[model samples]
Target: MAATGFGALDGIRVIDFTQMLAGPFCTQLLADQGAEVIKIEPVEGEDSRGAGPFRPEDELRAFGGYFASVNRNKRSIGLNLKDPAARDIALKLADSADVVVENYRAGVMDRLGLSYETLRERNPRLVYAAIRGFGDPRTGNSPYSEWPAFDVVAQAMGGLMQINGPDRFTPLKVGPGVGDLFPATLCAFGISSALLRVARTGKGQFVDVSMVDAVLALCERTVHQNSFQGEIPHPEGNRHPLLSPFGLFRAKDGFVTLAAHFDAWWVKLAGLIDRPDLATDTRTATAAARVANNAFVYEQLELYTMQRTKKELAAVLGGKIPFGPVNNVAEILEDPHFAMREMILKVDHPGVDRQVAIAGIPLKMTETPGRIASRAPMLGEHTDEILREIGVGIEQAESLRAERIIG
Candidate 1:
């Protein structure tokens, strides 16, 4: 791996008290931007480390793909917060950090005596962020505040599942954990914005993000449509609600998406598909006409598309129209576009015998582009180094380790 030189957030320090996906993912984004993030895990390690796709050859199973992918570019320190000594260590770390992030149930940190209100008293410049299923009472008390939620729960309640899948009657949870990820992404942005305010005012603030709220924000268009038109939106499968020929269609071998929605594009599409007469036909001449006669237009287009292979269709319609073949994971790994853009990266895993390939950073900056500096840390990999930095001597560190206070 290449050195990630002084990045945009080089001077920032983050004390990460997050686990699972949402909070860890938020801190991961900060770490990617060059923040010094110290991930504090329990003595047994973060839960995701046990959630696998583990290497069959590895016996210790220190971490898995789910943990590794979201935890790259950060240091790990295992501390049993159940111990008062460990809690002191965490407070000390937070006192020196510019930001502190957590995603536990609302009162977990309070019970641990490490809540943002307590921590900010020692370090007022600290930006504290929380990611929750509904939201914190500090921001707004949610009816489901105390209820435990997972990705599926957030998707089902937040209106995303209602507008997804093949039809209104059958709603499917999205393949990825967008419910957790979207909230985490928003929390990252909230943290960054809070940091800017701290820079100007020298005062820290609480940043809260709700997973349900985040998902609803992502489905904003649906909310407006329902309010304005009094129309309850439902899944339309592979077709757009208002546009014609703007969705996925079947090719001879696989599937392709062709979006020719404008009047001019509709004419071009008709001519390209050897249906020049359809370009001037009253039923399919204009955008509104094509939408009104959508079934007929789609049937005609499918007849032409099903006769051609994906490559054959692309050859004629690639640049002429908005077209792309549906690519699976295997195809994406072999794609030149992903290679040229560095979207796929291979990283070395310390315990695992083989290298692991994961998705790369998407943000591109001309001067301070983020880089994956290192693979995720081994469990408690920096315990000694961190203890030394915080003024613990070797003998005392050994004593703490022996007592299982620090791992």
Candidate 2:
């Protein structure tokens, strides 16, 4: 038998009805931590399967790098929720599953008769988690609740874009799907907590994650600035509002971040910049003074940094002063630390000829470390197997396939 990589959530089974980033990312975390994740896709597959940069040769299989990134270490079972027979199979799967995770809009699950109320009647100990652009039912519905949301939309409306960018004149959205991934990680944490409670008390709970809420939670520093001090935060480019010498500076080749958060480090920074006078200068001595003379202090730091290469700056201040170079994707991929941690992995797929490097699981454990057992499943690859386990026989499974209920 294959080692299941069963760690914390070994015996727990998750029926995942999530597609794309938020939901899949949640389930991938669970899968990585030893939960058995059975992803239920639409009969034709989730829209993500058709999304691209696709492999030229295998259009049907290697749909997109985006989908491939988050859906690893999971099993895919296709079901047409619109069909009665397929719905029955879904209910059966839910009955057997300890948790059900979905990112559907507010009322979609109820319309499909797969709502928690209905599913809990079958299995009362099922943890139901829902991820959304906004909050769940308890928060009340909004005009845009039903409207589909992309990461950019959430970032724009959820206050992330407001405080980002170099200045107020130019607002920038965060590069990756922070709007989605943040909420997904929060939802995963809540879901696991609910599962732990279920194990102890034989009771299930609802887990709701709002992308907007998650984004707001991440803006904690901004909140503290506004709420306590009545100071409205603006785009301050690379400098930390409170902590001086704690942002990016221009090095010879590129940019590097120097987080001299402690006073000792600030003293060291003054030495590094060859301004020993600034170390004890009353107008630039304390943290408050450094904040007051922010422009002057940053200018002094930049002058020294601009004379040295990023690598040279890093060599001097990397671990000592909490400094790091701004690494792009290519630099990150080539980094030795990333390789040592196995952040990059090689995997073979029937669809893709040569083994390509994919991201490996981030959570490491000594006893039962996670593994990338298989590639993301082709649409409906495990449909028959999952259905049969749920009490649909081979003949009935074939009939459902013919009827477009199973694909």
Residue-wise lDDT of candidate 2 within 1-407, one digit each (tens)? 11255677777789999998999999988887777889999888898876766666763564567777788778888888998888888898899999999999888999999998999989999999999887777556666776678688778777788788897667788998999998999999999899889979999988888788788888778788888999877777778878887898998999998887578988887787678987888867888888888888888788789999988988777777788999987998999999999999886665777776778878899887877776677788777777767677898878878988888
Relative to the true structure, how large is the alpha-carbon lDDT of every model? Answer: 0.89, 0.83
Inter-residue clash pairs, candidate 1:
none
Candidate 2 pairs with clashing backbones: none
The stretch of ten residues in a row with the least summed lDDT in candidate 2 is 1-10
RMSD of each: 1.7, 1.8
For lDDT, the strongest prediction is 1
Best by TM-score: 1
Estimated TM-score for each candidate: 0.96, 0.95
